[model samples]
Target: MSMNVSEFVWKRLQEWGLHRVYGYPGDGVGGLDVALEKAQGSDGSGMEYVQVRHEEMAAFMASAHAKFAGGVGLCYATSGPGAIHLLNGLYDAKMDNQPVVAIVGQQARTALGAHYQQEVDLVSLFKDVASDYVAIGTVPSQVRHMVDRAVRIAQNKRSVTCIILPNDLQLMAYEDPPLVHGTTHTGVGFPAESKLPEQEGLQAAANVLNEGKKIAILVGAGCLHATDEVIAVADKLGAGIAKALLGKAAVPDDLPYVTGGLGLLGTKPSWDLMQDCDTLLMVGTSFPYSEFLPKPGTARGVQIDIKGDKLSLRYPTEVNLLGDSAVTLKALLPLLEQKTDTSWRNTIKSNVEDWWKVLEERAMHSAEPINPQRVFWELSPRLPENCIVTADSGSVANWYGRDLKFRRGMMGSLSGSLASLGAATPYAVAAKMAYPERVVIGTIGDGAMQMNGMNVMITISKYWKQWSNPHLIIMVLNNRDLNQVTWEERVQLGEGKTESTQSIPDFPYAKYAELIGLKGIFCNDPDKVGAAWDEALGADRPVILEFYTDPNVPPLPPHITLKDAKNFMTMIPDEPELGSVLKNSAKELLSTVLPGR
Candidate 1:
């Protein structure tokens, strides 16, 4: 049987080791759908087509698939609106530096310039996000090279790429490039190699670290595979480590010297570590918030990164070592002289110990109905071993960042730089698909849950039974407000929460889960949060665990500066939930000074 261009595209993706493609059905992609159907009927060439409720979710799942599975994630969408819907998620992948390739459908080639229905200039639309590469398939011969280039570039650059397939061309028989001028041939696979810095550069970085009295190390997603190397370097320097939000899983929080997350959703220990350190060694992190880092001219900096562009961009480095995280660290280890003074390490440990206690006090702090922090506080110890965690952008992320302590072997991520809402559920779905035997959990705010998270529950309902481990849990913090933004307005803009803009309608999240043939558990009582988690985790199928949480409980930053203090104080007089806000704010502040009381 002669292979159509559409069939050839799928086969080419499979050759590059992609077994799953997340997408939705539309007439713009009808030819591709027919090819997919044929492939599905065949014995071994079939790809798992995860039909998502929205194209945006498909893109997000692809991003998550790349993040969790460590490969080029594949997603497809039909013309115009469907292609447009993928932008937000693709931006998430781009900002976080994950590899993802989008296969976009276009209207018939003949009608492109006629302004026919669904005729979109996809190449123009994708050029910014997929800035590394974006190409259109005008000929059957172009399909092979397009797929090859898209997959290879996405993986090599660790960024987004797009291949636009016209519906008319997709149905034509695929043809190999001819032995003639103007023809191009491309191959599958990017070779594996380890990059290491020069010995002189490694020694310079080591000397800077050895001379410092108090050193702080920052790691991001780049250190995910370099955990042991990071630990070794930190131990050698007697340094404390801070993890970027996207690099939460780079090192387990159980380490005494690991100071949780950094920046706005960061911990007090991390803030102190940065403030007090005389030298900074940033490994594989481009943590965006410079205000949260050591002030300029205060700390001497040294940075290691695979990308030279990312090196020293956040901090002014005395030495910049360009190499892969683990490889460079391994070579640099022999040059580092072990620190004899344990005072700096001891101070960090003390601060970290006090910080955890402060979190517990805040989590246990009483609220109007349920403290949102307590919900996550209760979940920390209950997390299943080796589970993959996902959180959407909202107040939920604050707790996910601050409270949940991830152990070694666990995996997690979110929309880091983009921080888009409605991403958690789809990310969890992709994680579960990638590792069927592992548990997965997604924490989302009520606003995000209603936006598109609920629709993804339908996607889960469609596929949960196929997973070997059916322990996927979606936890909704039902606070009835655009909680994170409301707090941001208060803290950043010194403005009161505008009722029309900040408030969201209440929905029965748990009930909706039940309606879709999944387990649903609803809890309003703060005391039973743990029991609710237990019930959901032990359920026979996937579960939606909804908690009626207090919206007034502030997601406070680690160390509130005077500017933020003034802004927060300015908003208090006109705040809608004034009393609850005052009470919770007092408790949260007191937690820092009155730990273990």
Candidate 2:
């Protein structure tokens, strides 16, 4: 059979069961794009090109797709700048340990060393970010084998992989059979008991967990498939469970021992439990915030992770178990002994309940405008249990971390690794694409909403009705400030005033959505917040709900430091409007310090 490299690559990608790829069309990639179009139009092709306004958004969508769907996400871009745009999002996947494959169409082979237009040393440029593997196609016969290697490496390594296709190679004819190594599947999951660690490690973990009183389990995304086992372990040991942000849905928030996400986005009960625990059982998460764990020498630790090296990366470990989270937890559950005393468990439950009350009071507080926390608090109960919620970084993440209770069976995230802005829309778009039957909600701040969102919003509008029940809802909070960073600056600087530079201009983001052929609901008045959300949620197509929120609302940390208070005091004087935020925080502080109910 006579075929070009692009034809062979697309056929193998189709066989790999990747029906959709995200990217923007650009120079030097005309051959691949043509091949992609042909593949989509053919019968049983099961392939679609998701054209995005920017190549970067394409990469962001692919990264989120990998995180949410647990598959090797595919993204493509032309050579040079189109290829460069993928780095930030690819790095997001790399840093967060997700599988992603970036395919870039390169300059023609004849253009080598000629400094041709739109030429770049893509393999070298991608090495730091796409470190799992990077290769360029030269021979037409090698196309299938290269795609096979890229997919397998990405899936096995849980990292980013890149394959470059020179324009000339993409159009070459060859006679060869495909040499593929993987099929269309999410890849290695539960029921694989063979992956469990040796008995020695499991027994050691069991002993540490059994002997320790006031044990706390910190769960990460690795615990996603092991929720039942995680809950069982917690129940048996009478341990409190704190989640890393990536593991927000590891267990239901309503569970007695399951304190919500830890670190800055953590709940107060999570802080209290981790702070007081004598032993910490770490599961499936490289949580990265060692400061949030129990004090040095305060808690002995046992960590279980699929990656052996990550077992004790964030905290000291007394026992290190290597295995898949579900498989390992199932094995360890039988070895654990039930605790007789309920005092520690009861203490954690009370803190979790009390924290909710405190959060509610804070969220419900009436500001001159609207309290941003109230938006999430109100949306929490209404969030469909099956919905996927993605939140952008900044002050909005504060509300998401604190108020948005992640029920079981939800999947979503922001720029967790890159901590970059403008990912919420792309994530929601990808979630809706991957599982269009479920509802997709994205809560973003005006700062991030204006950055990469507008473009992806158009992408959502373009693709919303293509599949079933996309139910895409984008809530843009126009707080008119780079609120998260502004808050960080105040805490870090101690005495500096927030200059005008920190403030953002309030744009009618909802209005913009309406203009772009989607539903737009805008709310500035405190009284109308519910109606806007309700309307956006009820809409069949994608809807943008932009709220004019009070920027004075602060994202209070799980545990406040003296520096935080001092900075809050210093800044509250300059912006007296933020006094309400300080007062609300103090109320929680008082509640914590004051004794029994």
Candidate 3:
């Protein structure tokens, strides 16, 4: 049986367990779209064909879906501008190590050398960002090989794979139709028999554990496969635990041993706790923030990681043990003696509680009209226990990171400094698609929400009707201005920079949400904010709660010191001695107004 090249490609996608295909249709790839439609009818597998507004959103959705579901996500785009827009999201997926595959349509094979319409060298454009790139010029020789290679690359490296298909190649017929097999799970097995740790390494780890009075455990996403084992080690060592943001849900945050995260947006207590520890154990996490790490001269460190390169990358390690975290911990457990005194653990736990209490008190007493802390307090309680919250980079993220508490089963994703707008909405869509049963929420700034919120609503209306009732709650902090930019401007200009002068367009977000088939509410009153949140969460369909907030309000970043305060004071000009007085007054106000300063 012979078939067109596009049909064979579609059949292969079906065999790879791709039920949903995300992309925008273009003239160059019209045949492939038709082939997908035909293939759906043949297989009796009603695959979803989702048409997105932008190729970037499509790629983001694919990446998020892959990350949430632990599988391959598929997306498509036309050549030139369409394919170019996908680079940002592709880079994000590559950095985060998610499995995604992008199929891009190219200009005709005949026009390869000539500069034709929508023509660019996509292979070169994606070479650095993607794990593998395959250009399918011939039917039998290239199509199957490329498809097989893409699947393998995505699965093995957990990275993006690009398949470039020319218009002419898609229309050509193959002499032999590609044989498709059902998707089968190639199980991920641990070492057949765990390798016992080297005696030298075990002895070194045992010595550190036995001698150290105060120890801290820093866990990362590398422990996703062995959460229980890592937890056991933390328990055995009686050590305080802190996680990287990527490892947010690695363990339940409510556990007494769990302190918090460490980063620019991380908690201050986590940083203080790390500093106080005499011995720091890096287990399964490669935390990127070098500034928050303990000073090499003061704290002795030990690292247990599968990747040897990450052992001493951030901090100097006295003992670098190269093995799986669970395996290494099990080996060292027997050699360790339990301590009778847990004064260090008790002290750290008390400090963490005090820090949290201070944070909560400030959020409650703050007088700012558009308080971000207040918004987080209201929304955090309304969210489901198993909610999957995705945050976009902005003031809202800073607020949420500090105030929003993750329940035992809740999961969240934040793209650490790749901090692009429009990520939250698409990420919510993908997460909802991946885990239909879990409630998916997006915490976005007004600017970020307006970027891709409508497109995600359309995606939900199109694909998610049959699987489960789509419950998407978008909490938009509508401060009407880019608060981050405003802060930077304030820092540059002495004191009274006219923030109202900034060109921030205020749109009718609630009306816009209704226009896009989502239930919408606008809450201006602070008291009504909680009611609005509750209503949105209880609703069955997609809902957007746009809360109008004070534009002059500020959300404090994680970890600011007295030196940082002095820096702010020094940055201001000494024109009116009153400016210095006002700076001091503002500092005093923040100390009293904000929590956990």
Candidate 4:
């Protein structure tokens, strides 16, 4: 049977078990649209082509799907502009080490060498981002091999891979005998086959750790499944655990020694512990901010990681253990000696306890306009046990980093590596799709919501029912300004107040959701925040819940430096309009007077 290349590609995708793919339609991908239509007509036997408004979002949705579902994510886009649009989202996967495959449609093969319209050197453009594998499938015979190679590299290596298919080749008759399909089983297998350093290396690392009095453990996303082993190591050494933002759930926050994230988004205990520790045991994290860690030569260091190249990338190390976090910790436990001194552990716990009180005072403050901290404070406990929360990078991320608490089984991220905006909606939609029975929540500021929220909400309405009992709730902190940028002006740029240029108009996003047949609620009264959650939870369809929060409320750093303090006091008073903005919403910071204990 002579099968067209497009149909052949789609058939192999089915064989590989990729059920749903995201993309936008255009002429360069006309062959794909035809195959997709045929698949849709065949009554659910082939892949579901999820239609998205923008190719950027299609890629983001795909990346998030991989993150939440634990497999290679799939997305497609057409020719130049559409191909370019996938870069940002693909980078998110690249930086986080998530496996994602992007398929780009090129102009016809005959037009490739010429400066044809909408044709780009996709191989060159995608080289850096999809460094694992980037290739062009030039002829019909290469389609299956190209697709299979991309899928394998993306999954086995946990990186991004791209394949460029010219429009002409997509329509050509596939004459090669079909390779045996559906016999492959490269399922997601992890807690990865135990990898441990040699016995001598493990002993040398233990010797360095054992020599120091004040030890601290900094863990990253690589420690996701080694909670007990990590806790055992911490308990054995009487060390405190400080998590990287990506590894927030590596171990539960309820443990006395598990100080939360490190860096700008870190907790007070985490900052203090890193500052005072004489020894640091780094595990599985590639946290880039060296300033937040113990100053290089000040502490004895030992690193345990699966990647040897990443062993001491962030800090100078005395010993490097090239192994998986779980396996290495388990192996090292017997070699570790139990600490007899409880004073250091007690001091750390006391500081953490007091920090909670400080956080509570800030969250419970009675301000003129609602405090943004209160929103997260309320949302924290209200989240269902099986919920997954995604916070965009901004002031809201600070609130999430400081205030939002993840129950043991819950999972989340704060756009840690890319630190991009407008990812909350795409992340939440993918989370809801991957885990239909769990509640998915997105907490974003007005700026991020306006950028990519509305379209993905529409995407949710399209494929929502495909999952079993899917529930998606987006909480928009609409303060009528780029709240994070406004605060950055106050401190980072040494400016007194916000300017109109950093502002956004308050759109009735709730009304927009309602108009589109989804539930919408625009809330201003702070007292009703809980009630909005109730109403949203009651609705079967997706819901948009917007809260008008105080734009003046800043995300104060956990550990303020002399430079940050100086920046706060150094105010820019030159702008004439600054005074009026203060007069109008100066009340935005009523709680600013409260002691940030």
Q: TM-scores for all candidates?
A: 0.98, 0.94, 0.87, 0.92
Query: Model 3: clashing residue pairs?
Result: none
Clashes of each: 0, 0, 0, 0
Error of 1 at 207 (Å): 1.6
lDDT top scorer: 1
Q: Give the candidates in order of TM-score, highest first.
A: 1, 2, 4, 3
- 1-597 per-residue lDDT for model 2 (tens digits): 666777777777777767789988876688888888888876634577889998888888898998888777999999999999988888888888888889998898889779989888988999888887899887766676678878888877788999999888887885454445632223222122346899988898999888998999999889988999999999999999998888887888877667888998778888888889999999999988888998879999999998877877888888998889999999999999999999999999888887788777777667658888889988988888689999898888878877887778877678885788988988888888888899989989998888888878888878877878857899988878888887777665654346567877768887898899999888878777777778888887788888888776667787788877777667655653456556655554564565233
Model 3 stretches astray by more than 4 angstroms: 41-47, 131-139, 175-210, 304-311, 318-337, 488-503, 570-597
Compared with the true structure, what per-residue lDDT tens digits does model 1 show for residues 1-597? 589999998888888998899999888888999888776655644688899999999999999999999999999999999999999899999999999999989999989899899888888999999999999989998889999989998998889999999899999999999978999888887968559878888889888988999999999999999999999999999999999999999999999999999999999899999999999999888889998999989999999988788988988989999899999999998888999999999999999999998999899988878999999999999988999999999989999999999999999999999999989999999999999999999999999999999999999999998888899999999989999999999899988889999999999999999999999999999889999999999999999999999999999998888999999889988788788878888888887877887
lDDT of 3 by residue, 261-378 (tens): 7776677668877888888888877788887888887788888876566788889988998887777877788788777678888887886776667566545543334456677878
Model 4 TM-score is 0.92
lDDT score, candidate 2: 0.82
- Model 2: which ten-residue window has the lowest total lDDT? 183-192
Highest TM-score model number: 1
Model 2 stretches astray by more than 4 angstroms: 42-45, 175-194, 495-497, 569-597
Candidate 1, which ten residues in sequence have the lowest lDDT sum?
37-46
Model 1 compared with the native: what TM-score?
0.98
Whole-model Cα lDDT of every candidate shown, in order = 0.92, 0.82, 0.73, 0.82
